[model samples]
Target: MNSVSYDAAQRITLGMKASDCRFIMDEWLHRDAPCTLTVRRAKTKGLLCVVADINPNENPDGLYFLSWCVQHLNSRVKVDIKRL
Candidate 1:
């Protein structure tokens, strides 16, 4: 299994819509990887914390996909890969 974590220093206040978040999760689910997406509220008001656990055996491209997501969403809100 492989784990990836994404965190934003500030709350995603720009054009980040709920649909965008859902779309990412939906796309992930549609992939071959057996995975789970977890979002948690941070102590800071606007901070975003997201964690994904995926079966590497099932999806070798999981990391690349996640990195792409980060870049794609960067325009809306800045998210960094905290862990890999």
Candidate 2:
């Protein structure tokens, strides 16, 4: 399958520490490395692949990426829409 586009994917820039998560949307969010988010076909909740992290260049779009992690799954992770 093709990789999911930023728009198709749920922005997840909420409440996540910029230091922890790297933004990749131009000035919207900076990243040391582009995050590769993969969709899980699990019968249960799916998880994201948080492979590597980078550094930020500009402000984040608030929403970073979708909740691929189980911890964030089905939960409200806070982040600035402007950052995503």
By lDDT, the best candidate is: 1
lDDT of each: 0.51, 0.31
Off by over 4 Å in 2: 1-12, 16-65, 69-71
| TM-score (C-alpha, index-matched) for candidate 2 | 0.21
- Residue 13's C-alpha lDDT in candidate 1? 19
- TM-score (all chains, Cα) for each model: 0.47, 0.21
Best by TM-score: 1
**Residue lDDT tens for model 1, 1-84:** 322433312122122345566767677777754345566654456545555554445553655666666677766644543233
lDDT of 2: 0.31
N/CA/C clash count, model 1: 1
Colliding residue pairs in candidate 1: 11-46
